[model samples]
Target: MAIESVVVRQRVEDLDAAVPFYERLTGSTASRFAFAGVTLASVGPFLLFSGPDEAVRRVAGVAATLAVGDLDAAVEDAVAGGAEVVAPSAPTPNGHRAVLRHPHGGVYEYVGP
Candidate 1:
């Protein structure tokens, strides 16, 4: 599996309020999107999110967002290594994503074309 990039996950009360700070800090413009009732912004190496409590709770525990080379292969390898599937591979506004918990208990969100 090829790990292309890693994005730190951050939750906020409002995406509009949070994106500008990250943009200024990272010196990069934020790319915005919406998924499953939550708003998301990708700024440099940070992925900022905001939504209702229940919506946020649904995605809790994901340590970070990983950009991978191949979603299918990544999922296969993760499962082989004892990573339990939290959410199956599915399409996202940005691309494809899958959630899994590593053997050591860290949950991760993997994204790929």
Candidate 2:
């Protein structure tokens, strides 16, 4: 599967406070959305989130969010490359998602249309 993007994930206390600066820094307008009660904004290569601490912490371990051309193929490739599926594929507000952890202990969230 082709990797469409590697978006850095950041947790903010307030989306409104965080989005404007990220927009200026990334030079892209925010595309706001919500997932599992958390507020999210995609600005350039960054994905900013704000929500309850418990909800946000569940996804905080992910080093980055990968946008893939094909989620199933990406998951297969990752597993073949010594990665473990920490969270099985599931539908999110934006698309399907799966979380995986590599042998070296890096965690990533993969998302696709």
Cα displacement (angstroms), candidate 1, residue 60, comes to 2.7
Q: Where does candidate 1 have its weakest 10-residue lDDT segment? A: 53-62
- Model 1, span 1-113: residue lDDT tens: 98999999889988888888999999999999877788888999998888898888766568999999999999999999899999999998889999999999999999998
Q: What digit string (tens of lDDT, one per residue) describes model 2 on residues 27-68?
A: 999999988778899999989998898889876878999999
TM-score for candidate 1 = 0.93
- Give all candidates' CA lDDT scores: 0.90, 0.91
Residue 102 alpha-carbon offset, candidate 2, angstroms: 0.9
Per-model TM-score, in order, reads 0.93, 0.91
Q: How many residue pairs clash in each candidate at the backbone level?
A: 0, 0
